[model samples]
Target: MSTRLDDAYQWANSADGPVLVAVEERQDHELAAGSHRHARGQLFGSMRGLLSVGVEEGVWLVPSSHAVWLPPHEAHAGRSHGPFHGWSVYVAEPACADLPRRPCTIRASGLLREAVLRACNWPIDASTAPLAPLAASRGHLAEVVLDEIRTSPPEPLGLPLPSDPRLQRIAKALIDDPADERDLEQWAHWGAVSARTLSRRFVSETGFNFSAWRQRARMMRSLEMLAAGAAVSAVALDLGYSTASAFIQVFRRTFGQTPAAYRVRL
Candidate 1:
């Protein structure tokens, strides 16, 4: 783990602090953190590059403009698509009562970003009386940060996973190769389940039907590829889109911007 991540874990495990912020800048190599859980909820975001966070439920792609929220004690892991610059805010379990209860991708508003950057300068320890006023100010700032997080709208950056072993096998396969180009009947046969059952279960377990879920998988993968400097046309073809136009349309609908524009921002 990087120093910032280690500090985040320490702050998260400490009951003495209600909230703490950790900032990191890494340009040498991509980041890959192993699965772990802490006693505190985390709001993690990047100002540059893309990050993917995974939990038992699914994976969420965190673009530079968005953040992922992990409720307290949620087992999760994270990997950056490329060089990353980000911040993490750890909120004590007791202080997370009003936060979102599930893992999700949220808009990282300007106000929230500024508040976190400011809070980074506050003292990490809460026990010192001489810094009591600073600590109080930090507490109020934390409240603003939390409120911004609570009010920010969620982004459709997550690909939810199914619980059934059979469905899970299929989900993994699709994530491994989003360009598989298999129909429902084909996938159902591979999973050894009837097409009707596969279709129904996908909706019941993932809230998305087979086709929709596959498209979402492709979209998420495209985000990572694009962030890594893949050409827009190449990404479209790699993800099984018949034409660049089709991919561009989907990308625009999902993110309100074309892949090329997103890459420029990165």
Candidate 2:
């Protein structure tokens, strides 16, 4: 349940500068389910699993292709859909606001990934290093990557936080049981709301249709299993698909990658 600077912070703080840390084989439940912010801007990325970071209002999921940027002192807590190894880049405050303010999933281009790896070993005092020019070059590269991040389109599926208790209850239940066979009409009738009313409210609140939301939910669950190193056939069966081929088709349509490919990248 460590809730302080990540690896970078330890090194930086130890040397009175900056340190980048990479930790593997950790459980999110160990940290509890809450938000905590630090002075260092945080970059949370995992190569082999899904990570969820929640703020007061909404929760953002980091799929394989993306990472989350947390500005300095902006309270947030992270959870994984499955087992994961995380890398954190503890950048200084001056670099914080250059990242996104709200929660977003930014794609990790090859250049961006290399920048992160380089930053991990950044000298505690690069400002005065003999390779000062190299440090400056890395800074410029980071800035360029951040700019591209800002311009890139956010992930296609985002789980919007719902305000209404009625909707929240429904959302939670669905997450708990993705195989729940009830249609929106059945749910609306049970909730004493007409199907049309429920559909409109869902769109207004979550920006996804009832069916679309359910599909995303199912896909998200599958992603977790894949990240956990589950076999494709087993994951598909767990998600209620008739066969692995059906699951693969849906996954390809939604994420543009097969489960195996995504898992391999992770």
Candidate 3:
């Protein structure tokens, strides 16, 4: 990690400081922030490039207009797909009582984005005393940012993983090769489990049926490829979609926009 990032991480884990602190970052190369947890809740997003964040339960893909929320002490790691321009907001644990308890992807509203950017301008060591004028102003802005996060709808951008070792193997394979054409029965056989057992285990462990999980895996892969500058049609074919239109339809339904539109935003 760079000195700046190390400092940010240390600040986030500190118990006493600003109630809310925002950091804006721009990196020229892909970067990975390894697994770690902090004492403060966090909201992380990228305004340019794609981000893949992994928590205990699953992995979430955060696109340009979306952000991931991690409650205090949630172990997680992240990787940027390309050059990244983003911001991260860390909130004191006490102030995060009413926030979402689980990691999730939230649709970042314009107001929320601007609020975070504005907060990023304040000095990290700024006074946090309750009666200080600067502190008061910062408090109000923090409340606005928190309210925006609490009210924003979460996006369906997470791909939950199964806990069972058998299911884990299957999920890993699918993730490794989203173009795999294996059916449920075939996967069960390959995993050395009965078809019925595999089906039931998938739903119970991952909260998604085998087919749905595979679809989500493909969608996540598509997002990575798209963000890396692959052609829409090429991405479609590589992910096993029969045609570009079919992939576009699925992408639009899942992300509320076409792949090309998403790439343009990047």
The best candidate in terms of TM-score: 3
lDDT of 1 at 69: 87
How many residue-pair clashes does candidate 1 contain?
0
Name the candidate that leads on lDDT: 3
Per-residue accuracy of model 1 over 53-109 as CA lDDT, tens digit each: 778766555556678888888999987766667788887776688778888887676
Better structure of 1 and 3 per lDDT = 3
- The predicted structure with the larger TM-score, 2 or 3, is 3
Cα shift from native, residue 160, model 1 (Å): 1.6
**Model 2 clashing residue pairs (backbone):** 7-21, 8-19, 8-20, 8-21, 12-17, 12-18, 12-19
TM-scores, all candidates, are 0.64, 0.62, 0.65
Clashes of 2: 7
What do the candidate models score in CA lDDT, each in turn?
A: 0.76, 0.63, 0.81
Who is ahead in lDDT, 2 or 3?
Answer: 3
Could you tell me the lDDT of residue 186 within candidate 2? Answer: 88
| lDDT winner between candidates 1 and 2 | 1
Query: What is the clash count for each candidate, in the order shown?
Result: 0, 7, 0
